[model samples]
Target: MRDEALPTVTAICRALIEQIDSGLLPAAGKLPAERRLSELFDTTRITLREALTQLEAQGLIYREERRGWFVSPPRLLYNPLVRSHFHEMVAGQNRVPATEVISARQVPASPAICAHLELPALSSVYQIRRARRVDGRLVLYVEHYLNPAYFPGILDCDLRQSLTDLYASRYDIRYGRVRFDMVPTALHGEAAAALRVAEGSPALRITRINRDQHGRIIDCDLEFWRHDAIHVSVEVPD
Candidate 1:
């Protein structure tokens, strides 16, 4: 690598990230060709590849086999045994947890919501939105859906605390199992605003479906966090 051109790769990477921040490089959009990028940055292919590799490792880009690299989407993982509240999770890690309730209301269940909760189509559902924070750093935007019949006075509960614990103690309901799925998503305008991050910024998308010992679904939650704030570890049994 030429000493003078070495800095160019870093500079170009920074510029590309800036474009992403500015919404110029939209999510799921393929980046310009490597040759084109090199030409634009006035650098060699080697330097460009180095920069792309670094970004790829940072979870910013994905290199398809035989295909070119494109901006990578976000991913989040939830642990069933980590039965702590959002606040508790952060606190245990020596961080802080803050919540800003975005909205709370009751509405008719949609088809998707009805199927998930095994409820009637017109069943009422309570939706709560809260922006989550840790150590004063914004982390995620959470949306929770509960069967209104199950939590008649949910809004009156101490929302700043662990909702699961509250349900277990107050309603005698316990979640014996939790199923979650991770998916790639772009930051919608409203979610981005709540998270205090730019729209389309890399974010981890998590859907948590909770169930009791009887295998009845309790609640469905959607969480969006900054991609960099979380690390997921998986262990395979011997």
Candidate 2:
């Protein structure tokens, strides 16, 4: 008994889903441009876009700024309690993982970063910006601020590799106790640009404050992840 008007948004959504389910719009495949899709659906661009957005919110599709819409890939599982880094965890899940250092430099710590690292005003820190990919899909952009005092000459190290390994091998330091904070956020500025997503796209911001074996704050990480790209699960031991 459920029916919609001809060329309705719901009908458009259903048609798109059927196409996806039938392999017409394959996973990770870019959809037709909005103009083409709108013409095919015999609907206004606004209506077609609304349907597209609805599907995006359902995790059926996604759009990258200047890149257009695409079928979403399988979501990855993320556990905050795990000590594994992005590369390890992603590979463990049988997916390819990649990280590229976008920018790295010694900079004065802002008040927020200073508080996170317990540093004095304008203290110098190693600011490393990075973008990480899973299965060749850009999913996360992170900023790592390290206390330069603990890591002399770190700017010269190969930063594309995992910092977890770098710290252990080079500095003989290990991550001891760590604190995590997460909040729903919108992508903006460099983060959005790095991920190639529209500004204000739904995202998750995860802040990690890491401590060394001596219980000194070693560094902090700001991770911006696509909301639909991860399913966060945690296991608690009794």
Candidate 3:
């Protein structure tokens, strides 16, 4: 019985793949409801769902909480060394990019944040949280800690704009040297909820520290990205 069912499953999978490839189901397009898809595929719901799961594992589809599956978008290429803003890089790839400022406020730095910024314990730092989207898909959530001494009244500026541009125009500050450390980890807490992904989902956590030309630390950033939404590439010179 199982052997006979294998061919049916394979057929259903192939038909769906063909639809996706033919652009009938475009990237970011939502798949039909499971019941409708089951009927269309002329297969049992269990069998149809199994096929969908396989497609998801293959990086062709993704599921959202309380939302049906959608065709996965092409992964964004990220080059850390480029020094380009997020919007510019996404635009270079012909994709629309957007950023949302969740919140910005002055806060006392924690021990870890202080250490990263080389500030005294409990020093004031401006904390900014942002969510970035590509082609209408939320892909990254970031928390920025700025050394308040270097950026007085920085919170008054528009937080939705690119920080790189703001730093140059307002404070004559440009990034000098950046240190990046990335790790594969599970996202949790506010970051997970903001990205609309399940807690403990696989993600990449990247920490970046930026310094000024005088070697003064300007800010530290923590970014959480969905594992499937980005590809990191860097050219190393020997």
Candidate 4:
């Protein structure tokens, strides 16, 4: 007897699962509209819906009445989560991650950033503007201010690489913990252009504070992620 082949709906679901695992579908992300997917897969509406229903039942996908389907966020089963380094997170998933250092210069830390980083008045800090991309799609536009006292001439280093690793290996300083506050807000003016979204579009603004082993704040970064492209997850322990 020959081994049985998987059902058509199962095969469709498997294809989508492969895309998600490969980063082509993104994590905790919205799926294409049904019409688009039907065309892409050259399948009828009924078959597509059946495949989607099966995927949803398996907890691999979810559907919002008005928003359609989206990939479920990665399960955070255990560990309250220490510090999450963006560089490491992307690398672990085997994604093509790259960064562009838009600008780096010495500037007085803004009052807001200074307050977040807990710096002295009029302190000279190194500011870096960067855009992070996964597979050539812009994912995050970040503005980071670092204490010059700790990482001198950090602006000269290749920021496209991992800054966290650089700080650890080159300066013997590593981020011990971090705090994040995220909100959904409308983008406008320059921020809209950098993120390639229309003005007043919803965006996720994340303010992150990184602390060193001594519990001293090292860098305060503001990250803007296009709301349409990201899916935020909060775990509810059962």
Candidate 5:
């Protein structure tokens, strides 16, 4: 009787994927706890975990560490050529967007930071750290290092709002030329903690260097996106 209930690891993964594809497990919906899942799949907890881990690697599911696994949502389509900011872009795609300012202050730029904005080492810059959400799930963690010379007293404004919009309205600054660098990498330290995932989790890192309307370098951004949460969609002119 006991042996009859057990299923192979592949069988368990197949069962879960079938459920997910059939919409039985809705996107962003948390899967049952390990014990419950083991029973549901009629497999050992270890076997069940292996199946779940495979699903995670496939981007079919995501685990928020202690929060358990959730069905992965549709990836956010991102087009670098578009000028829309985070809030605007998410809204345009019919997804709810939110930003939380984690920390904001003037800090001495490190060598790497200085190099990105072409500033001297130890130059004072505004470092703004933020955790952003889509559909109520934390998906992006970004740090914005802004040259204070361009926008004075910017830290006093609402950091949760789109910096692009803020720059234009307050300092008459707008994007002129932008540079983008991206790579698939592993999450660590602050980025992993911000997204509630384990260190070494798969991630997408995007680095952007922004020059303002006057062609002056104004800021540099480091963005870490959950691997399953976004996909690039570039639109080139004919």
Candidate 6:
């Protein structure tokens, strides 16, 4: 029985691969219902699920809670060294991009935030939480902390727009230098919930500090990205 089932699983996996390669299952396209797929493959539900799991492990497919499986979209190319904003980068790749502002408010800076921003303890900072999507798929959740002293009326502006542009237009604060630190981390709490991924799922955490012309920190950003959704690339000049 085991031998027979193994061959069936292998066949199902190969067939699905062929479908994906042929564009029948286009990137980001949802797979058929499990019952229908099982019938088409002439296999039991358990066997069909096993086959799907194999494809997911290969990065050809992914599942969302209660949303069924979908063909994994091509990973977004990201260059941290580039000064372009998220919207510009994604549009350059011909993928639709959007930013949703989750929350924005002024908060007293915590010790860690204060240290990062080089501000006095208990200084007030604007905390803005946002989620970014590429091709309608949520890819990143970010929290931005800005020292309110630099822009007194910042909270009155639209927070959903490109912050880089906002800084330049509203406050004449252009990006001068940036520092980035990246680490592999598990999605948790607000980050996980905002990205719609399960807690403890693998994610990439990026911490960024943007400075202005005089080297004053403009904002500190914490970005959580789906590990499978982005490909980081950097060019080094010799």
Best by TM-score: 5
The lDDT of each candidate is 0.75, 0.92, 0.89, 0.73, 0.92, 0.89
User: Looking at candidate 1, what is the lDDT of residue 64?
Assistant: 41
- Stretches of model 4 off by over 4 angstroms after superposition: 1-82, 234-238
- Lowest lDDT block of 10, candidate 2: 1-10
Off by over 4 Å in 5: 1-7
Q: Where does the lowest 10-residue lDDT sum fall in candidate 3?
A: 1-10
Q: Model 1, range 1-238, lDDT digits (tens) per residue?
A: 6777768878987988898777788755789889999899887898998888778658776554345666644333434457677767666666666887788888788887787788986897898888877655556888889987677798877676678888888888888788878877887887888866557766778888888767778889988866765677666558
Q: Model 6: which residue pairs collide?
A: none
For TM-score, candidate 4 versus 6, the one ahead is 6
Reference-based TM-score of each model: 0.68, 0.94, 0.86, 0.63, 0.95, 0.86
Query: After TM-score superposition, what is the CA distance of residue 115 in candidate 5 from its true location, in Å?
Result: 0.9
lDDT of 6 by residue, 132-237 (tens): 9999988899999999888788878898899999999988898889999999998888998887767876788999998998899989999998888889999987
Q: Residues 46-162, candidate 2, lDDT per residue (tens digit)?
A: 788889989998989999888899999889999988889889999999999999999999988999999999998869899999999999999999999999988998899999999
RMSD in Å for all candidates: 9.7, 2.8, 2.9, 10.1, 3.0, 2.8
lDDT of 4 at 223: 82
Off by over 4 Å in 6: 1-14, 35-58
* Model 5 per-residue lDDT tens digits across residues 1-238: 2444335767888888999999999998999999999898677887788788888999999999788989999999999999989999999999999999999999999999999999976698999999999999999999999999988999999999999999999998999999999999999889999989999999999999999888999999999999999989997999
List the pairs of residues colliding in candidate 4: none
Per-residue lDDT of 135 in model 5: 93
Cα lDDT for residue 186, model 5?
Answer: 97
Backbone clashes counted, model 4: 0
